[model samples]
Target chain A: MPPPPLPIAPPDTDPPGIDQQTLLAALRARVARLEGAGREGHGAAPIPVCEGLGLSGGGLARAALHEILAAEPGCGAAFAAMLLGRAGGTVLWIGAGAEALTAWPPGLARFGLLPANLILLRAAQWSDALWAMEEALRCPAVAGVLLAPDWAGDPAAQALDLTASRRLQLAAEAGGGIGLLLRPDMAEPPPSVAASRWRIAAQNAAGAGQGIGDPCWRLELLRQRGGRPGGPWTVTWRAAAGQIDRESEALEAESA
Target chain B: MTAPRRYLALHLPAFATDRLRRAEPDLPQDVPLAIWASQGPRRLLSAVDLRAWAAGLRPGQALADAQAIAPDLLLRPADPEGDLRLLEGLALWARRYTPLAALDAPDGLLLDITGCDHLWGGEAALLAEAQERLWRAGFAVRGAVAGAAATAGALARAHGDGPVAPSGAEAEWVGPLSIAPALRLDPALLEQLGGLGLMTVADLLRLPRPGLARRFGVDLLDRLDALAGRRHAPLRPVLSPPDLGAARDLVEPIITRTAIDALLDRLLDQLCAKLRAAGRGARQVVLMAWRVDGAVQEVAIGTGTPLRAPAHLRHLFRDRLERLEPGLGFERMALEARVTEPMSGGLQSALAIGGRRDEAAAQLLAQLLDRLRQRVKVRRLAPRDGHWPERSVAALPLLAPMPEMPVGWVRPDAPVLLLRRPQPIEVVALLPDDPPALLRWRNRPHPVLRAEGPRRLEPEWWRGPGVARDYHQVALASGARLWLFRAGPPEAARWMLHGHLP
Candidate 1:
């Protein structure tokens, strides 16, 4: 476990970088700067995360992994659940395909997510999805919204501004709701004012871990808002109870 | 690509719902007919006038007096539900003109006939045909056409014939006409003009606008300038044009239900396949059956659900086909789904239901009931949406589906389905803190087999009285149960039948 492998930083990027502690400090400073600007032309309130939340290392790979796992909770149920958990808003799963709710990946409910909080919006096209998401966000009743591909697109700046200013995150925090963004694996994630991003991948067990099932890799956090990227960490998969355990023993052994 | 050559505009009255309700079999042509919601003339919910002649009928017109002067006038209850459904139907009808038609209101529609207008002659011919069809269906319609919206609206309101202002004649057509109401001027401006002796549209056109602006404001001047074709005003067309729909000519029209059903099945599949391929589903479906003679009989069904499944959707229209009259031999059939929703494939599981929720079946059943109610009369079907004994059920539209309650109503642990309008019930109860020993409803006394305690419901203190009640669910020995409630404060309760336990 030789500290896993660090991401290949852009050339002339201070070679191999500093230790995780120093990188974390720099990222934290940048997030604070952006968060301070707060969207309303007024200064934003400090991000109220407790001291215990994890941070990503200077590696993009680590950031991506942290973002996905933190956003999505139930790996087997639907990626939406994870996103909702991370974003703190409701999830609206919609599509003309099968039952939108039924199609959710497994293991969501096991993590204590309720379907009532997740709204399912129906749309006829990409444009409709955007309109639906914008409308759903205006509703203060919803904690936050997890817009499945059923709600995505590049809408007019006015429409986007309406959703952003609603402070959907604040509503979710106040009402205890979560919003998730579930999209196609190949989809170029639409430009949104999302707090973070993660690309999920399925990981296989090798060698002596043969008897265990393949654990899912949330990969690394591509981007995160207001929080330092947590260094790349492997989450061991558990099914009946969907919990991702960080391999602390492996990390320590590698560091020594 | 070539620019669209023609576009047709359809205007239904802002109050078309009220108009449809008061449509009469016989009324002298051009005579003003107004429909205002009433049940013996108290409040005028809305008024629809056939002729755009007088600017009278102020907001406070006494209903009885208004009807007294206009004897041959028609009046009925306002139906918001019916209006939405009818608007949807007309939207489907406009599809025959062009697939680019979009809803403009509960009343109006905008269609980009463009190259398609020639199919029904030219734009003027198309507009005429539209009015003719609506007139046959008992509608009083006024229409006009022009290259730009401002000029068209002005002409339409003024009863001037229009297609365009004719090259270099923009000022001539709009200048002479009086300003109409839709320009929505401030009442103060009109009042001030009335004082200044400027009464008619022609008067306003003659006035010096600079003086008017100094006295009133820039608003009136701007409106007058816009309508006079001096200033530019753009039309906000409600819908982006959609790709034209596809239709196949049948070899011959089949009269039999099975053949018709089979044809619909095929057409539905074809239409749905195209929708899926394009990732869309239709919200409105049009079924056209061409009789042996040139006339076409059409039955349209609006879907609360977006189109995706062809088979289930085909079943939706199966009931409708059985009801249509296939007069003479059939020659052709066409099916079109007008409003579409996004179509995509995903591997998600069914939504997790907290309890036994038969949403799909309930939806289907509601649809059937709505259709039956619509055919018989909209008043026949009522839907219950509350836990209160009364005011729980409401008259609903046939085409619209009932939305799911976010949470099954949080009813107090009391059993009974209250009537929409509570009926007073005679009751003989024990003293305070005691369950009812006997209750008489509909002129009969029932011995209480199992008496339940009072579920006290205080009146909304801030609102008013009339809502003060204490409810209870009582079971009679005769295997009959009743939801009983007492009106008044807790200290003085008067019993009534809040609802029945069905």
Candidate 2:
């Protein structure tokens, strides 16, 4: 049989000045750009948070899955709520079992997430919760999807494999929305395909003669796919300001 | 002026027996079947099948006598309710012949086929088609058409079958029918008339008017006049003519999901076209599939807002289509808009730049929510009117407009997670009303480093008297904040863990 023709241009047919390698590289780059544009129309802009937290792009990337783990008991939910509020569109909060019934509207409003912009979905099973999360993430009408699957009772069901997370990531990319997976800190976390991972711990904000102050958290950046991971920074959630403020700066301002 | 009114009446002679046969088609046809009813001391046959009728069995005959006559007679207790229900169902099914169909009680249906006859060619053709369809459906139907409902009904019941009586010929058509059975006269009156040799309706019509009035009551004259087309007989149709509905009868029964989906698409297109023309939208739509085995499977879907888009409506029905059980396939399907509301065209102010985008986004969100609702429960949270933590927020329907947050009611320091039910915790405090210094919850101990107030909240008076709860916000040794409450007096204090504050 005759040899199959080359899929691309033959060496002899290449332009005099431009080599095949350079041309191929340029073509590949263009194709990548086009594919990215097709998946995310107009490209999704990253959501900027406080500057000192050290996200390489100056913010959390959109159309990507981010894992938030609670080093303490309850800080992960708070952090996820703050991020959802910042995204500023319809947020689908999906949870399973008892975790589904824990979202308080008043508390959500404290983080600048209003009741009108939030849609709460409660699934009884972890699989259903994950499915709902993926579906919500794929809808362009939604701004973000927050899934907190409780598999504490079933040891076999606790791990969400890499394939499942990758599917969610792809769906998020197609929809141009953020995907936040909130979970409790595990002794040895299962393998994941998340773009970034963070650990949040509650910080005491009360001082002498001062009652309970605004919630403060110590946020630790544990992993970042293509950027430097640097955190363990203390920040106070100033509800009145509708943003997070550095703990030292906030305290100094309060005293001054 | 409108053309003279016409009605077609159908009579089912063996309705009770036929209903059972239709329900259980495996029943033996050669055997003599009878439906018996208890009358005081004796059980009498209320209805008998064709075979039983041929064997000289009759209604109102004693069951013992019937058994003696046919020894192998099949008997079933008469169900008057089931018989009437079947009759009503037949009346609804008869709507395929005309828009206005009404029940003629026990075992008959009346269709006001005034102008509808032309659709099936003519009155005779329409009657023949109706009878043919009914016969194919396992019914022995005798039908007649005349200028008046009373005349048609009387002729159908008396003559067993007849041709259409042209306009102004009701009297001639009913003249030859026996007066006693045809006009449905009282037994005593029938006996008296029989004694006087007045057997046929023509003979009674020939008698003097005054003497007939003096002898019989006004009801007798009323019946005669109605039959003669001198008085109008009104009918209450089973369905109003203006109801938005579309139905298709399949030549070959279909069982595959693809076929059903195609049929649904066509029906939805037809229904949505009607809705668009009427400048209205449906709020609730019902889809009914009639199985060949005489069973009907119905599924209904309701929309949060008026909708007429076929694609959107089809999407809403996609999930519910699986619920339809197509046993032995379906021969007929019907789609009806049970509830409707007037709808205007498109989004308002579509010409404007921002308004158009906003409207499109709102529509997209509504559609997304509708799709989510099919697989999961989607709800929007709203501030509720209550001081208790559990009652402070309410879950509203996804489409409901968000109500304004109640003023001065929400606490800025409310917990991020409020347990649906408070969990009891072991607490150690310097005083009963003070914040917990140490707490143990879920078999875990937490030492409180700093504490907040004992904000006392008294139970609402309308909720009946209850102990005031002293609530405290405390920071645990691990930096997690918890909402704790103590109830009852100092000596009998009970501590409960209520919420997790961020």
Candidate 3:
């Protein structure tokens, strides 16, 4: 919650003679205080702050990097759309290289995101993709950025090191847009400055052994800044609504 | 009233040789190089370098004779067309000094620098600047400014180099110059004048006009009057292209990144202020850094929205700064807004609850698009004036709104992600008319928890592929509700998955 301790390396000072960072920090603190007082300044940030855990009542902080680890092929994208969709802003989906399909993958509205509002950007190169994603996050109009770079072929570019995440975080903060990085891995993710990290896997819903029931997935909260960090919870991935539902009668959540 | 016109004649001596030397710096300097032209029965040298002239090989010499004098003489065929094009290009660039520039053909540019000279700190400074630029551009030039185009051209060709003849000085300006170029006479007339031993322009002025006209025709007297400021013949200057941007030239070339950044800040302030004054906004900014070595480094930045604020423009330029390929050191910098839009409603609106949110979303998306161009292709869906399920609506680009649709029309509830091609699935039904009880897809069975649809749609002959389909919205045991359709007759019906209902 206190930000996993600042990195070992001290914050690098700003360029010589232009000490804007100090002023910037002071302004940020003042803004936070003003927001705390329930008074928004002119041109309020596009992305609203999150209440907690999921993307409801402000699902994710504006311009924050959120990594979703997916064990299954399509679950991470589906989950990302589900969250950003509910946040109700323009959505940008960036897929780097030919690894991504041409068409928009299914299940955007199932989580409450409008399919029409989704803007799909196909990047020819990984660097272009990363740059565009960061640029999008820095724009006030964009609500979310979903970056899916080519991880298998170009790990050097795909690796979301802490520094890269920090850069994305800075861009996101500038425009008050949310950033979501979807990677395919069930294990602990590499070090990153993302505010929230999740792991997801598609699983059989109860009694969905032969016949498909409500879509169920193993949803794990690997790291959340202010949330239950430990989780292997089974939640029904409502295919149509694009939300994680855990109801007693319809959902029946189970411990993974 | 029309702006008063003053002419500056730019004489590019050795234009071909100088241009070729600049293009091929590795050329042998010691060799006598000449641009040759075929004149009827023999190949004659049209232009020769100093080395060739020093070897007693003058222009118009037979190519064989020149080669005999300097056995290793380098003779390149002259390219008159390319030379003319280069002259025209320089005329265009002269706009940096004045708005009116004209080509004198062969190897000269004439500029009307009547009022613009003050901007460069006076006439001398302006002439000095033009001369310095041409020298830097690898041309050996003779420039002279005068009230008359003919006087300026004569002075530039004969006696003056970077000389300025003030107003009403055209007659005196040509007095001390040579007769050959001052008269601009044909070779035959010049030879006739030489027979009389009249070589100086003053000698030509001393001759009676009636005698000169009887000997040299009316053109000779007419040209002499134009050169002496007795008559005014307007120069047909090439249309001056508009320069709607600002540029800054440094006293000393700069190579350091910090200096460039500081320079950029000043330039952005200037450019954005200009845009703001015009009630216009710029979408793209092109930064060109003219290096000391005569090279130009250019970088262009595009913004998602019309930008009038210097800070945002600076931010956009920051990302593209890496693209500037500065060679040596930069001596001049220019900022131009290549694309512009009228600033709409002052760039900001009252922060309405929904409007702010939409603006923010649009801004973010636009920013992303600006960085990664051609990446996002939004297929916009809009209601069309049709009745068929597929034809009733149209998918277009987001920028184009759909036309009016039929009244009381509403888009039916459908899956957000629809399969463009319906995938086949095995279905089991209790009765031919009843909804499917179960279906199998991807080799997995889906038990029908509920069946809701049989919304029958008939084929429309007006639309092609006019096949009928019995559409159904079925709830599966997997909790995934799908949009399905049956094609062909009931006796041999086939079911396919069309989409999923959210």
Candidate 4:
């Protein structure tokens, strides 16, 4: 019997020429050099995703997709919620498939997003999710939208190739809304016309135990339309004051 | 002030047997036929047709006794349900003439012909038209028209044919009606009335009403007052089909698309204007076009949200309007806004109607919904009180606000997409209790790369017989993340694929 094609394209999944050990060492060395750049005079500036990588906000020339790929089950959702809480408007999460649901208020509040302000819509088809996103983004009232395609893979999800992403980009432009896409840790996103795309994976804090980690992630900015997207950066989200802070000491020590 | 109402009573005295005879048209009219049903021991006749009445066969007579008196009497068991159903169907058919039609149970209909009778040239012509139609439909209907509902019912029962009592002469008209038909009393009371030589309504009215109440029951006085038009009996229609709809008579039979579109626009503007004044918006709009050849073409459109704007509402009808065959030509068009919601502050404000962006987004949704040829609906997921992950949530075709999940709600990652039903799979597990390492689903082998905890969700046993499930998040080597559950306890378990995560 012949073997079926592999689901993940090799180049997309591992992002060629960088091992985990080498990537971590490089991120730590760079973090030591640009540590205080994050806590700027502007108190609540978005935490920089990576070297030369900023969050998609405030005069980006166009509305775009901020893709976050998680290393574990709940990590991507938490990371996506972090970006959503700072979007400054009502957030719509489409098709978050959880046992009960992913819109747990207290679970998301720790990541600094209000579940009350979030409205969840479910679509059996990925195409319907895209359609739902387009309708929601036509009005400026929606500051951002997070889409979790409910279907695994079928003709329904096949509707969401590059073409579907392009349509979302156009709709966000019209409504001036930002879109965030949450994919599984190893799942490959089809070629999308997203203005910006970043991959995020959960990283345990020095002492993560008993409960989930305190929202630390290794973020990779793979795509940025006009600006240059470099390598991975370690980002930490603080829940007490609802802010994102950069950690450089661990990165510096790892490099040494 | 509300306009004075005129009601027409359609009374079928032999409703059960009459409906049976009509259903079987070959039944000989010369035969004495009565419907009989067993009541405890003996078969008692429940309904008798006209021929049975002439042959001395009556209701409540035992079938054998009735057969002895009239040797060839036809006996069929009484069907009261069939009788009521036919009567209600006839009442609904009467909606074409007047929107207000109510079924007076066992066998009667009260039609409020107030302003509608004029459309058939007058009350007498309307009654005759309906009588002719009912006769053609195999019903022996006694129709009577009066200013009051009870008076019409009493008059129709008394006179076996058409009888139109004038508005002011209600008392005089029922004055001569026999007391047996006017007010049926107990045999004892009836004998007393006969002994007193009071055979007609006039005799009872002539006697002091307070004295009559003392002799008989107080109901006799209420019945008499209702018949004399002194007391009003409110007609309880099945559903008063409202006059909320708007219709138009075209100057010329419209044949072209432009003419039909123009008429629809005019009708919608007028209809929505009235709806707006009533502080309501329509959720469903029906456009019924009565063609010149007497065929009615209808187009119905439903919306996710209430709508009142004429252009937006008209746009919804464009696709359905194309499907409406003009046939010869349409003579009139009627627009009905059946389901409505109260729109606050009259018409929707142009900017930020409810002072929320969701309202604007919802409005924008209408435009996209109009262009899409799919059945647009808002699906909702609500957490049901249960322990099983499969039974923990329910789906409804509405967008109800999600309440906060319970404090301790937690489970391993489940799929956002659920198959219509859990698919049982062939599995080869590395261990007895762990999730299957290799499972064949839909004729394909998916080897497990990594797996998560066996999140145990016990069945809600209080509900019914159910097996507890051990759910797992399995990432197949093909990069598929599936929520698979093992049925029953770990000692004896079978695998079933349930959900798919993104």
Candidate 5:
């Protein structure tokens, strides 16, 4: 299904001297300036080319909180690895409970994340994991932080409320690194102050004959603060090339 | 030629009695006291106080005979271990006079005061000062200085309070001393020498050297030669003090955290200065707090890398400060670097260049890791050489260097989330050797969509015998991919879910 069209201001509502295009450009520049003021030295980290074309700034803003939810059970690790591969410097991976022991280095290496550049912290509880994530996000040496707290089974577990996530966002801004919070797909997801919310699920590879090929994910942009929220796009990670490309483009290229 | 070596020997004759008096200050000072030890069938007086000596009772006399000589003699059992421990303590205290101090065993201390006498005016003044201090501490001490350790020890034991022997006058000084007590010879030999009228060392020296050696054996000659500076005597000094340490004794015992933190800050500053001067860094440090009630509490911290930055170390110790129980207030606090490593000095600049920025970032990361480790377990994964999924990667220390992996070695198509222990699953396959078509895991049934594999992984032979496993990567109907494996033959095969792949 196609996405709904963006709501546009009618032509009649424009001022006497300004056109719609000019006004929109002016507003965009103003937002860019406002956002750039908090994030200096660290600019936007470009998403892969196929996905970048869909977002307004062609990338995700650095030094900001972004949430990635796994609609299916096992696709979160690959999605997080794909995003962390684009980050520079050291990456701290924080997790709790049985989820903590699941990050296999060799598998992450396939996604272009070297084991040497990664520090794995296994927190004993959810609170400790959150504290570690905030601490890692505030360290200038760390370029990225992946917090995968296991909040799946227990409904009584304290969710990451707005205040907690806001603190993490501010810490990321101070340290100039991107923070990724990966959680199991929830019905409401409580409340969060993250800049963008994304839901991803595993998708079967289209062209592989009777075998699993490169990992493919259907990524959906649920909410974005300053960019267009649109997705459910099928994307494939080419491990050999260390790049992510749109599944359709990949197929077209292969056929050609 | 180098000047001759000088040694100062201190003999505590009433050490056993003195130690008891110091421990129990209420003991009667004028009463005759003697410590006895069992020697085979009979108990003998091992040590006697000055009062006992004045009462005509001496060590080596049987307790029964000593009681007959002095009816009011105070008796106590001999503690050889305790006496040796006290001697060791004295040796440590003697280090303040000179860095080289050794326990002479039983009730004596040896100090190599070769070039150290000048620091305390002269040899006589140093000896007088050491004797006065021991006397004030309730010990009956006799001290002497000579060019040879054995000569000094013999003079102190036999001649009581003797003048320091001039450098090359050891033979003359030891010539008039009694041979039995001065040379510390065997009692049987002493009796034979007594029968021959060899009472003084001079009488034995006047005899022919070859005849004397044949009569007394080589040990006596070795003792005589050592006393005359003809042989070298080796002294085993105590363990060296800590490389870097700082301590502060409070006039008013402090119990508040602020006061303790202030004290800790000053101590850290002093310790860091010492560390800097020695070109070293502390890997592990312990903070010891001595309470007014005589109880000691300690807290220790370790760093992943060698560090001397006081602020970073203080930060690491911040949370651990709560572990110390400051009961009745702490009278003293000491910080010691228990483990140290060599670290090169680096320049600190306000403006970081390209390389300097990297250095700063690395240091920041190390500090972050240390802080995180205080609360949780932090590690880095390193690839290991193995075909088995679990053995292919190993957890390494946070700051350990990652070695270069072997070239041309391709990483296997492993799952991202490898379970620590595989979960059992019920599986149905169309053929006995094919991949699973349907599976039940965690009590949930799922139909396998795109099944792949029977990738056989042989058990490591050197790790003992184990069944071979045939793994299959199956895509479930719910969009979850699972790594499943079958162990043993088809008739008795067991299936398990090992990992979740993306």
Candidate 6:
């Protein structure tokens, strides 16, 4: 499905810069390519793409992270390696309390990602959490961020607006770096100004003794500026080994 | 250093000493005596004048002038270091309220209690409780809550000159206030702002941004940005790192070691799960046993390393619980961990799997030493840290690990009577090299056995109260050995018993 066109201010044609349309186009292109390759069904249930490569496979979130890195490894190699290596960075992983921060490292590490690129600032209170988040956003050299929404719900509207603005500011400052806002379990996807949004969850696997490939998750490409929302795709991850694959369920397709 | 966004400046009267002096001769609380310290003959550096200050006399006046005004002015020298230490201790006590508390400029503190207000009911309640505690400690305090450091400082000094600004309202609060000289703003910038008819912060704030940026340097703009919340500023807190705490509640209270073992199993399981979830593990576990007889017994067991495993942790607690004197039937038992470290999942097993079996076994054997330490109440269980024999492996209290080298040692191979501390021994000998031909200990002469040295230890030249000694590892004829040393450089020496072998 095509994304709703963002209401942008009158055009300032000062060469090319990030705008809603450009983002939408990128999203659309990505969706079309996934559809064109006959990989849409397989995406919802990611299958091992190792027919020839003999590669290991796993779940979707890990797949996306790996795919993102495989596509542009050098872009975040230093940061990615640092986070995966368990070195520390200035990335503020926000959540309700100790539980949220505690659940992060292994989840990321399951995808062969290290939090070495993160400085764990556990914000027991919402106000300090905001302060920490704002501080992390402003700091340069902070590669990518993982944000877990406050359990108390959305922050003050002004603070949220400021944070959204900070996302753009951080992107501009870091060239190609991005921040991930992990929303709590949502009925419908929450509105965000993120470059993209992917819904991740654990899924059961078919094979025995495979340790259920990195907890398969369904990824719904909800928002992209220049692109369409790619149909939900299933991705499998083998986290420890950092392998990801796509699987297609024919029975589910027929039922749908 | 990370500067704070808000500061709560506190001012205490200099009457600390006068109160002490007034109490010397059973000083009456109502008499109003002032205490001031002085280096100069007549000048008073810091004063605690109950009568004069109460009568509107501020600190820093000459003693004679104060005496003229109030004849009973008590003078004493101020120990700034002591006052600072007291404030630091208070800051530690304040951490129960919020973790983001920092030291404010001398005699003040800034707590970044953004959302921690509810812990003590509300901010007002918290402040009231804090004030009550301090008042009991005999301090006169005036407090004001403001959003910005500048506003808080100004208003506190002015004794609640303005209302408390809600969070994010610092810009408005500070705008109406004057920028005092103590705020440390550049004089030139102040003059320039003053020239533009901007005596108050509001005047300076109302000017166009471009003109303000052009006139004043980036510092003013930065300050404005921080004040207006355009950019967030974080406070670098001086409080201790957050604790990793875990507790357990038993369904049924049981007192026996087996029952305690089961309870520990459940608690360790939950605690380790929490620690793993947080990417950390525990270094200390405190077990509290509530007895049916209205007495609560607590046994704290500290691990040499952070252990998150249920089984390994249970074992550590098992060793500690064996010695507890359970006076009554237990009603409830709880196990909690106090300290923790980053979760290193595979490091513990790496030794077992890496084929370094002997080294790992040695490490386990070393752990036996810790068990011995617990049983014997030896705080320090490590081999001596220095090359000096007498100072090596000096036993300390089981709870207090020594941070410095001790002054005595016992040779591992030497057969000697061990003592906790060195004591003077009387000996009669012809020369330093010769064995103590005769030695009088407890007024008895012991025949010479084999003796080691006048291994001379020179007096520490750089420090005072120097004691020189000539140490010898001596074995008595009756097979009772002694670690003896002669004091007083090589020339003038007297023997003493330093330590004995186990």
**Maximum-TM-score candidate:** 2
Off by over 4 Å in 6: A1-256, B1-35, B43-56, B63-90, B118-141, B146-151, B159-162, B166-172, B175-238, B245-338, B342-413, B416-441, B449-502
- Order of candidate numbers by TM-score, starting with the best: 2, 5, 3, 4, 6, 1
Off by over 4 Å in 4: A1-76, A83-203, A208-213, A217-235, A240-256, B1-3, B12-38, B41-99, B129-140, B178-200, B240-243, B248-266, B276-307, B315-502
**Ten residues in a row with the worst lDDT in model 1 chain B?**
B346-355
Clash pairs, model 4 backbone? A28-A251, A97-B416, B415-B500
Model 1, residue B416: C-alpha shift (Å): 6.4
Pitting candidate 2 against candidate 3, the one with the higher lDDT is 2
Calculate DockQ per candidate and list them. 0.01, 0.38, 0.14, 0.05, 0.35, 0.00
Model 4, docking class? incorrect
Q: What is the C-alpha local distance difference test score of candidate 2?
A: 0.80
> Model 6, range B329-367, lDDT digits (tens) per residue?
565565656677775762442222112345443234223
Candidate 4 backbone overlaps, count? 3
Residue B492, candidate 6: alpha-carbon lDDT: 65
TM-score of each: 0.38, 0.71, 0.60, 0.58, 0.66, 0.38
Ranking by DockQ: 2, 5, 3, 4, 1, 6
* Regions of model 5 farther than 4 Å from truth: A1-15, A28-38, A47-49, A98-100, A151-155, A206-208, A248-256, B1-243, B347-357, B407-412
Model 1, residue A107: distance off in Å is 33
True contacts kept of 3: 0.18
The lDDT, on a scale of 0 to 1, for candidate 6 is 0.48
Angstrom error of the Cα, residue B422, model 2: value is 6.5
Which docking band does candidate 2 fall into? acceptable
Q: Write the per-residue lDDT of candidate 6 for residues A5-123, one digit (tens) a residue.
A: 99988776634677888887667667646533222231233322222222212212111211111111111221232232331222334443433212223223323333222333345
For candidate 5, lDDT tens digit of each residue in B236-338? 8874545678887788999989989999999999999999999888888878786664446778888878788999999999989998888778877888897
